[model samples]
Target: MPKSKRNKQVTLSKTKKKGREHKEAVVNTMKQAIENHNSVYVFSFENMRNLKFKEFREKLKSTSRFFLGSNKVMQVCLGRSADDEIRPGLHKVSKLLRGDAGLLCTNLPKEEVERLFNEYEEYDFARTGSSVTEKVELKEGPLEQFTHEMEPFLRKQGMPVRLNKGVVELISDFVVCEEGKPLSPEAARILRLLGIQMATFRLCLICRWSPDDFELYIEGPDDSDIESA
Candidate 1:
C-alpha cells in the first residue's frame, strides 16, 4: 500500500506486458538458429508505407513465419541488441524494429523470400502495376526479369532505370499510384504475365517455445551401422 511499493508494482506490470509472449518466441528462435543449426532468415523492406500496405503485409505473411517479439526479450536472449544479433537472422524484420518495435523471426530460403515479395506484383492492378510509384531498388540476382518488365511502369512514375553492373536503380523515388484510376486492362494483364515468383518451399517450423538463453534442434538416426555392429 506504500507509494513506492505501488510504483514498483506498476513498473513490473509494464515490463511484463512489454515482454509478453516475446520471451517464448525468442527462446524458440535461439533454439532454431543455434541449436537446430538452421539458416538464419532475414528480409528487406523497401516501400512499406501506405502504398497498398495490406497487400504488402500479406506478401510477407505468406512467404515467412513472423512473430511479434519484445525488444527486451530479444536482447536478453540474443546477448546483444536485436538490431545487431538479429541482422544475421532476419534482414527486413530488424529494420522495422530499429527501436523498441516488433520483430519477425523465421528460417526461410532467400529465393522463397524474394518470391513471396514479388507475389504481390499486381498490387497496383494494371499495366502500370508492374511499374509502381514507390521507390523500389532492384538488387542484382535472379529478380532482374521482373524488374526489366517493370521498367515502363517505373518510367511513368518519373523514375528512369537501366540495369548497370547487374543491378537496377531508380532515378527517382517510388510513389503510390495516385487516386482515381483503375489500372488499365492491359496493365493488369501485363502484371499477370510478370507474375509473382511463387514460393514453392513451405517454411516448416521444427519447434516453438521460450527460454532465450537455450536453443532447439532435430536429428535422424541411421540403422545400417548399428545393425552391422
Candidate 2:
C-alpha cells in the first residue's frame, strides 16, 4: 500500500500573522497627521456607541481626524521617550494614552474644541454587565403597554407576566434591576422593552499638545470625569 498524506503537519513559521500591515498603516497616518495638524489631543470614552461616534466623527471630518485602536500601537507612533518622540513633548501625551483612550488631531481652536467636548453627551440603553443607576420596579397590574402575544416573551425574560383576557398582566411586583448592581441579560432586555435608557455615551479629554506647549486638563484625582476632546 502507498503512504497516504491525508493530514500534514505545518511549521509555526509557515503560519500567517495578522494586523502587521494595519499597525504600519496606522503609524504612517499618525506621523502624517502630526506634521499637518497644529494640535493633538488624548481623549477617553464611556459606554461607547459606534453609530453616534461615527456621526460625531463625520461632523468634524473636514477639520479634524480621530484615531481609536490599540493603545500600544498609538504609543509607538508617538514614541515612548523625549529623546525619540515624533515631536517635542509628544511622549507626555503618549503616556496618557491608557485604557479606552484615543487620539485626535485637528485645526480647530482650543476653546472651540473644549466647548464642543464639554457640551456633548448622548443617552443609550444599558447592556449586560452595566451597573444600574436606579431601581426599576413594576407594580402588579394589567400591562397595557404590552399585547397578549408578548406574554410568552415577557415570561421568558423572567417577568411575572401572564395573559389575562387578551391582555398581559403581572401577577406580582417585579424588580427588573436594582441600583448599584450590574445588569443581567434578562434585566437589560426588560429595560429595553420598558424604553428605559441608562447608559450615557460621552467622551472626555485627558490632555492636549501643541507645538509650543502641552497642557493637562485632568489634574484632579478622578480622570473619569466626563467631557469631550
Candidate 3:
C-alpha cells in the first residue's frame, strides 16, 4: 500500500477509537452519578450561557451533579429497552432525553429544586443570527450612555451616529433590530453597545425519575412567551 494511504487509514482508525472512548466515558460518568445521587431530573435549556451555567453548577456543587452530553449516549446509559434497563424505571426518563437537554442528579428535595429552577434566569445580549424578540430603535437624540469617543465605533456598526459636543448622538432614528428578524452582525453589536439585552439563559425541567416512579415535571413555555421575553 502507498505510504499516504496507510497514514490516512491510521488517522481514521484513531479518530473512531477516540470517539468510542468518549462515549464509553460519558456512559460510565452518568452511571456513577446516578449511583451517587438520590434521583435524576432531565431539564431543557434555552440561549445557553456558559459562564452563567458555570455559576449555577457552582451553586449546586455541594448537593448535585450535572451531566450534559450527547442525548443518544445518555439514552444508552439509561437503557432504551426493558431488557437492559439501567434501573427499574429509568428507561422512561431516558425517552425524554431529547434536544437541548441534560441530566441533573441531586440529593436535595424536589421542592428545593423546583424553587431554584423558578428563580434561575440570566439575561445577556443576543448574538448574530438570533431572531430579535423585540424591536430596538435608536432615536435621533443624544445617547447618554456613550461618549463622543464611541461615536466613530457606533457609526462603524452602521448606526447613524455622530459626536455632538462630548456626547454620542444619532443623526436620525435608526432601527437596530426588528422583531422576528434574524439579527445581523452589525445589529447585534450595536444592540450590545446600546445595552439592549435580548437573550435569556434559563433552564426548564422536563421530567424526573425517582426510585419508585417517573413523573413529567414542567410544561414548556408558549412560543409567544419565549419570543416576547
Q: Which stretches of candidate 2 lie over 4 Å from their true place?
A: 1-17, 220-229
Candidate 2: residue 115 lDDT (0-100):
90
Q: How displaced is residue 151 in candidate 2, in Å? A: 0.1
Best by TM-score: 2
Which model, 2 or 3, shows the larger lDDT?
2
Indicate whether candidate 1 or candidate 2 has the larger lDDT.
Answer: 2
* Model 1 regions lying over 4 Å from their true place: 1-30, 33-37, 44-64, 81-108, 118-229
Clashes of 1: 15
10 residues in a row with least lDDT, candidate 1 = 211-220
- Per-residue C-alpha lDDT of model 2 across residues 51-97, encoded as one tens digit per residue: 99999999999899999989999999998887788998888888889
- Model 3 lDDT, full chain set: 0.85
Measured with C-alpha atoms, the lDDT of residue 62 in candidate 2 is 87
Angstrom error at residue 85, model 3:
1.3
Compare candidates 1 and 3 on TM-score and give the better one. Answer: 3
**Order of all candidates by TM-score, from best down to worst?**
2, 3, 1
Q: Candidate 3 clashing pairs?
A: none
* Residue-by-residue lDDT tens digits, candidate 3, 143-171: 99887778888878888877777888788
lDDT of 1 by residue, 1-229 (tens): 5577645543445443536475676666754554443343322233233445454456656433443335555445544433555334332222223332333343455455445545543322234323343222333334355456566664464445655565555544433333344444443443444552211212222222222221222222532322222
CA RMSD of each candidate after superposition: 17.7, 5.2, 6.7
Compute each candidate's TM-score over C-alphas: 0.28, 0.89, 0.84
